[model samples]
Target: MAAWLLAPQFTRSCHRQTPLTACKSNLKNIGTALEMYSTDWSGHYPPNLNLLTPNYLKTLPECLNAERVTYRIATGLNAPLNHGRFQDYYLVECTGTSHQDVNIPADYPKYTGIMGLIEQ
Candidate 1:
């Protein structure tokens, strides 16, 4: 009886976390694609995320949250200042409010050339 009662709660918790997990995974994959694209392009990152498709990435990744928005590349004035040239440093972020339930690590830098998923 107790096991049955807890099953629903456990399932609900897992369901809530699915989107968050997917969002992180998507960001990581996109970051890898970005790195690969930069390497092939002689150290210059693409001007937009769409340029990564069918080459660096099989296809563009989308946010798994309720809004289901596409992840955006943070460049130009939006890119972090300490990361050197704007073309060398870019950040990818989900533009949805659904993933704010979880907190990111304090030490995690916004742009590391590998993965940068800002949840906001």
Candidate 2:
């Protein structure tokens, strides 16, 4: 009886966290793809994420939110680069406020909903 009463709340919490988990996974995958692409392109990142498909990634990853927002790339001048080459890029989520229930990554700025590969 007690377990049954708490099941709904647990389910709802998990449901709410699903999108966030997917988003983080998507970001990590994309980051790996970007690094692979850069490794093949003389340390230069692609101008667009679509270039990663069929080679670095099987397909582009999308946000799993209610709006199903597509991820956006912020590269070149919009992102920090290494030695004037596009060695870094920022992948931003649409709407930017849909995933705030959890802690943002230390490398990622707060409330920006942006993830990226920054060359150290």
Best by TM-score: 1
RMSD to the true structure for each prediction, in A, is 11.5, 11.9
Question: Total clashing residue pairs per candidate?
Answer: 0, 0
lDDT of 2 by residue, 1-114 (tens): 011111112223435657656665566666666666666777667777677776776566556653453555565545532234443444433335555555543233211123
Task: Judging by lDDT against the true structure, name the best candidate.
Answer: 1
TM-score of each: 0.64, 0.56
Q: After superposition, how far is residue 111 of candidate 2 from its true place, in Å?
A: 12
Poorly placed runs, candidate 1 (over 4 Å): 1-17, 76-78, 81-87, 101-111, 114-120
lDDT string, candidate 1, 39-94, tens digits: 77777778788887666665565555544545777654457542455546778765
